[model samples]
Structure formats: C-alpha cells, structure tokens
Target: MSTLSTSLFYGGLGILVVGLLLPGWDTATLPRRAVKRRIYWGATLVALPVLFAAGWPDVQSSLAFTAMACVLMGGWAYFRTPNIKVGGRIITADPSHREPDPTPRGGGRP
Candidate 1:
C-alpha cells in the first residue's frame, strides 16, 4: 500500500476504534453516539477509496476485496451497536449491527 493509502487505512482504523468505544464512554451523551456513528460511517467512506488505492495492482481483486470489506464491516456495525432499532423494533447489540442507529429520535432521559 502506498503511504497515502496506508495513512488513510490507519486513520480509518483509528476512527473505527474511537467509534466502537464512544458508546461505552457514556450512555447519556447522545452527541457521543452521533460522533461515534459519524466516525464509523466516515471510516467506511474513507475505506472505499483507500481500498481501491491499496488494491490498485489488480482492479478486479481490489474491487472484490473492497466490496467484501464493506459488506463485512457494514454487517459487523449493524449487529454491534447498542440502542440500534431495526424495522421499528429494538435490537440489542449482536456483534452484527455495529453501525450506529439511523433514527434520530429519543436522545434525552425518558
């Protein structure tokens, strides 16, 4: 991987770590969840180009790897994050949906 791609990969990895940890840092801070979710998505967004750049030697292989990475990461995110509700139903963290909840409701104490 080129220096740029490597940097991006590491940066993305760092963001992913932060995103994964944010929720544990605080439960009451909705902003933290938002930030974590943003970081996770941002890392995935950055990964696309980096994956292309990193795997440029073989376009097809690179694309495949990129797609796989996206799917796996997305799947992981979808099953991991707490407070994630799907299809109007609440689902606990399942190591599958790590992605932040998409809905924007319920940020304060009930």
Candidate 2:
C-alpha cells in the first residue's frame, strides 16, 4: 500500500477510536433517538476508513453525497415542521390543528 493510503487508513482508525471512546449521554439506556444517533455516527466513522482505503474518488463522492443529503434533509425538515407561538409558548403546529387567536380576550386588541 502507498504511504498516503496507509496514513488515511490509520487516520480513519483513529477517528473511529475517538468516536467510540466519546461519551454519549443516555446512550446506555438505549433510547430510540440515542440509538439512531449512534448508528448514524458509527456508520459515518466506519465509512471513513473504508472510503479512505478505497481511494480519493470514493471519499470525494461519499462526502459530496453526505453533504447534499444533509442539506436537503435539513431544508425539508425546516419547512415541514412549522412552529407557531401560542400563549407565549412556541409549539409545532400540526396540519390537523388550528392555531388559537393571538389577541388578548379572545379577539380584542392587546
């Protein structure tokens, strides 16, 4: 193996170690969100070594795809969940729910 590939492989392994050693709050309890986070992060870390080992092209494509996916998902989620202020509290407004009047006294001016 070339020196660059060797370094990348080792570097990926190092990242994997760092990821695994990092403390995760509430992960031990196996909550749904925690497990999902771990799975996604773990997969990314593991993919680093494999992509690095595979060569630069694979790494480039993988990174581009990941970045694109993140941006698209972020924008989609941002628009999909619209937040509404109700009685001084911010809450997500569901499609089936109607927002209450913001004016004081059920429609009177504040």
Candidate 3:
C-alpha cells in the first residue's frame, strides 16, 4: 500500500479503537456528546484520504483507496452513527422559547 493508504488505514483503525475504549477509560471523563464528536471527526479525518484514493482514476490506487475507505467507512457507519444523539430533551431550547412576542398584532413593532 502507498504511504497515504497505509496512514489512512492505520490511523482510522487506531482512532476507531481509541473511540471504542474511551468510554471505559478511567483517566478522564468524557461526556457522551464529546466522545461522539471526537469519534465522528476522527473517523472522518481518517477516511478522507481513503475516499480520495478510491476515487482516483488509476486502478492500483483505486483498489487501495477502496480498501481503506471500506474499512474506515464501514467502522464509522456502524459504530459512529448510532452514538450520535440529537434533539434530546436535555438540550435546552433557545431563549426565544420563553420570550414574549415583540411584533404588534397587525403592524410592525416600533
């Protein structure tokens, strides 16, 4: 494999494993959201080069790229997708949620 391909493959794999282990790690506490974000970005960063390689016009490069991409994307899609929690009840709404209306009944507010 080319240097880029090897780097992407190994880097992605390393990030994936670290992300998996982060929850159980006792060194420091990482919030669920933060953990998810780290894993997402890490996996994405690792896969970018692989994706680029897979899309290359050259056959050998494409094969290597595809392999790396598959590994990274597969792991990312499987593990990372479900961990992302959005719009949960704990997420506070904007201040506008409690604010009174500023506009007049029919015309623009002064």
lDDT of each: 0.57, 0.45, 0.49
Candidate 2 RMSD to the correct structure: 12.8
In terms of lDDT, which candidate is stronger, 2 or 3?
3
Better of 2 and 3 by TM-score: 3
Candidate 3 C-alpha lDDT tens digits along 34-67: 4454566566566556555534556676566557
TM-score of 3: 0.36
Alpha carbon deviation, residue 12, candidate 1 (Å): 6.5
After superposition, the stretches of candidate 2 with alpha carbons farther than 4 Å from their true spots are 26-50, 53-110
> What's the ranking of the predictions by lDDT, best on top?
1, 3, 2
**Judged by TM-score relative to the true structure, which candidate is superior, 1 or 3?**
1
**Candidate with the larger lDDT of 1 and 2:** 1
- Candidate 1, 1-110: lDDT as tens digits: 67765675566555455544554222443444554656666666766676666666768856875786677667666566544445645455575545444433445531
